[model samples]
Target: MTERRQSVQQSPADWVARQAELYEESGGTEGTTMRGAPCLLMDYRGRRTGDWRRTVLIFGRDGEDYLVVASNGGADNHPLWYLNLESDPRVRLRVLTERFDARAETLGHEEKQRVWPHLVEVFPPYADYQRGTSRDIPVVRLRRV
Candidate 1:
């Protein structure tokens, strides 16, 4: 399996670049909404290709860190961003007025159980997103590196 897969045909359009632009122009102040829910643009390099890719993901803050889930809206497959992170665990993130280096890791089961509620709180759709699919949604915490 590749560290990053080809962009899916149904993937959101220009979401990466647009989010970057919005975030940059806002001096990190704005451009945080994705489909009406709060999101942050995650940037990482493909482990196989070594090219940069970005995805917009629902996010919640934890102290000085950020949390993202590979919900894929409860789809059977993990989201492309999940694959990208699998490819290269090191990543960069942009959230309202701040840019930071981050390390991504899957949460343990108990940790996930604890954090899942936190994710849903940031974006209530996560609970609904969980119910719509059979795959186990993964919660990844991005800690500053």
Candidate 2:
């Protein structure tokens, strides 16, 4: 985590509360954070709206790096955070108390299948969620910048 990334700020008290619950509890092992995966309140300014959007995301480790997904739990609509990143490209991400400068990039199909299983190890519900919808879930790489 860099000081530059840490400097980005967020709002919405309820969003903050959920973030605390998700990260502190260790991906829902202790309690729930939205979809039962451990979550980190990702704070970013919308590309179009410019309002800060705090999104809760499921994460998995790819070696030392963190990976995120735009599964939306197989929702019909793409997650708002995905659109926000697509519009802006640059981002600030947090995992528990740490913050990092990041850029989200979509992964290839084969890569997604490989990485998603690791995510399932962390939070198993994702495998089941994939079956619920028709859209292809996007797996994102959260590279440290």
Candidate 3:
């Protein structure tokens, strides 16, 4: 049997590390909620290093797909995970205790427009994040592979 690789923690924030630990150690059961909303763990290969990196993100459901925002708290650029996914769309997602393979797709303007409201409803701060930055935030849909 092939050995499983441990995920590398890339975020400098203490909470991120802590949250990831709590979420992962519990098989995504304990720390499944973030900011009072459901969260999922996304694992992707780093764009440059090619190492496995994971992050916990709040998500909204789009039928069978999951919706995630690249707001980076309204920063001028996209989040690292989003950028990594851009380089490689293949990823693994953990929702609660279940794990699955998925493919990430950046939504175009028209599709983003159609899905934006549902996202905003799920996480109200998304609207505020958009207003805080001039750059258009991207909303990615993670479809099951």
Model-by-model lDDT, in order? 0.77, 0.68, 0.87
Candidate 3, position 3, lDDT: 29
In terms of lDDT, the poorest run of 10 residues in model 2 is 1-10
Better of 2 and 3 by TM-score: 3
Q: Report the Cα lDDT for residue 68, model 3.
A: 93
After TM-score superposition, what is the CA distance of residue 52 in candidate 3 from its true location, in Å? 0.3
| Superposition TM-score, candidate 3 onto the true structure | 0.93
- Across 60-143, the per-residue lDDT of candidate 2 in tens digits comes to 878766788787767877887788878876666667666667777888999888888788787786677777878877778877
lDDT of 1 by residue, 35-145 (tens): 676787777776676767777777887777788989887788998778878877888777777777789998889988987878887888889888988788898989988
The list of candidate 3 runs beyond 4 A from truth reads: 1-6
lDDT of 2 at 48: 75
Which candidate should be chosen as best, given lDDT against the real structure? 3
Q: Can you rank all candidates by TM-score, best first?
A: 3, 1, 2
* RMSD in order of candidates: 5.1, 4.5, 2.1
